[model samples]
Target: MENLFSHPESEPEPSQQDDDALEPFIITVVVPTNVSHAFQGFTDHPHLWWPLDQESVFGEGSHVEFEENLILETAEDGRTSVWGTIDDWQPPLSFHASWYPASTPLWSTEIRVSFRAVEEGTEVRLVHDGWEGAEDPAASRASYAEGWPRVLERYVRFMGGAVA
Candidate 1:
């Protein structure tokens, strides 16, 4: 049975292809807060907004936080997982990080989030890129495309804003 599943010894190497053909996933939202408050809410209060029960390594009781240069998720039992690391930590303006939830840094993707004060409130933009680094760039991008919007909706609600 093991031999039946093995690849042929004469199989040719796969061709190298450009994964950058996939565009970055971008999302923008306006919240009823100033830029500074928006940034603070995103960075300092993710534990309150994040859907830990649905999107966590330990589920339900797990909480996530941004500390120093790392985004960490800690379970009720005290076990922690690193979801990502901060590549840039500018406040009230923008921040960049490499996100790799439930995966290794070797397959990481880049995330950049910016906040700007607008007439209505604050404009927050998120760009998730670097698809070339992902193991299955298209599938990875698709999963995040579905997941990020839900996550951002939670953030928007936490900021006391409606998704328009």
Candidate 2:
């Protein structure tokens, strides 16, 4: 899965890779922490950092676990729902996942996040691609472009990292 998202890898930062009708939305942020810590903020501490107001498969107060191999949510009653599959699970470096949220569960999109240690701290780059799966790719991309920044802002706050 990493191989699938490693294209245009020469760019240290975010690089756009246009493929057919889909264009990847790249969001890069600098966190004031080590690579390992930043990675943990995204994976291990998702419940603490991820914005919960958005559309979710398990709804609020659900026990959500975004693991290396799978993303799942469990209700209080023990009902479980799977949202995505983590294909590449490299720690402190990168990971790739196929995301299928509740709103549009019929299809999936590719999400890749890379963590790199920098002089200031860590660089977390997120790429959300595969918009072709959406019913309205352009609209969905537009919504995410506005939403991801806010979500990352919350993550930076939770990690005590500054977005540079």
Candidate 3:
């Protein structure tokens, strides 16, 4: 079967398309580092790149309390959870997480980040799958299609020297 999560020919455009049949959205970002350092920064230093505006589910060392093995994010007003249970934690090479939206049934696809060495830097490939069950799969894909670029751009800049 074709990898639904493979990078599409083009990013989803909200206006021109129906936004109801958009398929997998893949985003790959290259950063200046080897596999080891890239993996380290991705998991250990998430706070540096994770949007500060959003609440965090996992901090320095919070206990996993839920039966479902999820990381909970709470604020004064509301709470949300994005799949945080670690599927694989091998360092400096690959890591996978369940990418499920909080408040939804646990239908998750693996998000695998691979680090490979290149002439200029390490290529970070982020693939978020399991989109078939999303509430609005097309809309979700569209949103992520646009969002990943911005997030990756921030990640690249932050890695380069921009402060959070």
Candidate 4:
């Protein structure tokens, strides 16, 4: 899974200001399914499972969909938003994206998800990082500490389990 998170040569190297490792938060949960079911549940059927936190991402009447690994939120009024870009799309193993939640429009936050087969099911790990800027970064990071857990709870319920 480390190989999946590595960047290409063309991408700029991380700087001191772009550091997320020092203050990033992570959430790990076990879903009652195989790698494929867990990965597809997050990537393909997110609209069905993802927490409909209207204040975070999609707006009212907007639905999330994937286009060539790009996450989009389109509304009935024809307003479409770029939710995030899937940086890595290795199915049933891992996926990473530059997430632009509605609350943080200044820049994107990085989200890395990894799936591994476990004795009971698949262990899904989520790392939300790349929080730059000022105090908002810290505040945002703290806020997500609460938010991701709720989101993962939904994932667990949708996956037909209580592990998360």
The lDDT of each candidate is: 0.90, 0.79, 0.61, 0.78
Per lDDT, what order, best first?
Answer: 1, 2, 4, 3
Task: Compute each candidate's TM-score over C-alphas.
Answer: 0.86, 0.77, 0.65, 0.77
Candidate 4 residue 104 Cα shift, in angstroms, is: 7.9
lDDT (10s digit) by residue, model 4, range 9-38 = 697778875465347788899988999988
Candidate 4, poorest ten consecutive residues by summed lDDT: 51-60
- Which model scores highest in lDDT? 1
lDDT of 2 by residue, 1-164 (tens): 46775668466753353342367899998888999999988888777766666645556777667854888766778987777889989987999888776644567787899999889789899999988877777677887788889878988888887555
For 77-148, candidate 1 gives per-residue lDDT tens digits of 998989999989889799999988888899999999999889989999999999888898988888889888
Please give the range of 10 consecutive residues that has the lowest summed lDDT in model 1.
Answer: 13-22
Clash number for candidate 3: 0
RMSD after CA superposition, every candidate: 6.8, 10.7, 10.1, 10.8
Alpha-carbon lDDT of model 3: 0.61
Which prediction has more favorable TM-score, 1 or 4? 1
Once fitted onto the true fold, the runs of candidate 3 whose alpha carbons sit more than 4 angstroms away are: 1-22, 54-82, 105-109, 161-164
Query: What's the distance in Å from true for residue 82, model 1?
Result: 0.5
Error of 3 at 154 (Å): 1.6
How many pairs of residues collide in each model? 0, 0, 0, 0
Write the residue-wise lDDT of candidate 3 on 6-53 in tens digits: 997898666755543544566777787666777677665655665535
